[model samples]
Target: MIPLYLLHITTVEHSESLLWTFLTCNVFVVTAGIVFMYKLFTQKKVRGAGIVFGIAIAINYILIAIFGDPFDLLG
Candidate 1:
């Protein structure tokens, strides 16, 4: 996602494409993190991975907020 965002910064015309890909990647990561948490709490599975994913989710949110959404640049 960071790489795509960097590329998007360099390329002007393909901004939308990069933003879409970046957003998709972010959504996928966030979804996976939620799934991990659910499985960990409900099924008592993915013990170690669940913690890692939870941290990842937090970091992703922070970074996304700091960087700002690429889609916002479109308008």
Candidate 2:
């Protein structure tokens, strides 16, 4: 996602493509993290990985909200 964002910064066209790619990557990561956390919690196993992933996902969401959506640049 960072690499795509950097590439978008260098190119004037195809910004939408890059934005979609970035957003999709983020959504995939968050979804996977949630699923993993759920499985860990259900299995009664140590949740250290789950907690870390959860925190990372939360931070990602907060940063996106604060920084503004890349799609907004389409207008």
Candidate 3:
């Protein structure tokens, strides 16, 4: 997420293309996380750091979608 923000900042000059870039990144991360979680679940080992990390990422993405960017609201 930090890296995505950094890329967003660096690509400010290309705002038109940034939309697609950001969307693609979001899709990729969420999809990968889901796949990882599913694999872990099926193996009967759904405990530990990987699950926690995936849940955290999923929650963050959900909140962002629900509330809009907190940073954006400040302005």
In order, what lDDT does every prediction score?
A: 0.59, 0.58, 0.54
Per-residue accuracy of model 3 over 1-75 as CA lDDT, tens digit each: 555565333323334455555556566666766766786778855565466657656654564444345463232
lDDT of 2 by residue, 1-75 (tens): 576565234233445664675466466666767777687768855466677677766655554544555563442
Instruction: Arrange candidates by lDDT, descending.
Output: 1, 2, 3
Output the lDDT of residue 28, model 1.
Answer: 63
Stretches of candidate 1 off by over 4 Å are 1-14, 47-75
- Predicted model with the maximum TM-score: 1
Top candidate (lDDT)? 1
Better TM-score candidate (1, 2): 1
- Model 1: pairs clashing at backbone N, Cα or C within 3 Å: none
Q: What is the TM-score of each candidate against the true structure?
A: 0.43, 0.41, 0.41
Native-to-model Cα distance after best TM-score fit, residue 5 in candidate 1, in Å: 12
Better of 2 and 3 by lDDT: 2
Once superposed on the true structure, which residue ranges of model 3 sit more than 4 Å away at CA? Answer: 1-14, 44-75
Q: Which residue runs of candidate 2 sit more than 4 Å off their true CA positions?
A: 1-14, 44-75
Q: Write model 1 residue lDDT over 1-75, tens digit each, in one string.
A: 576565234233445664675566567666777788787778766877677777766655554454556553443
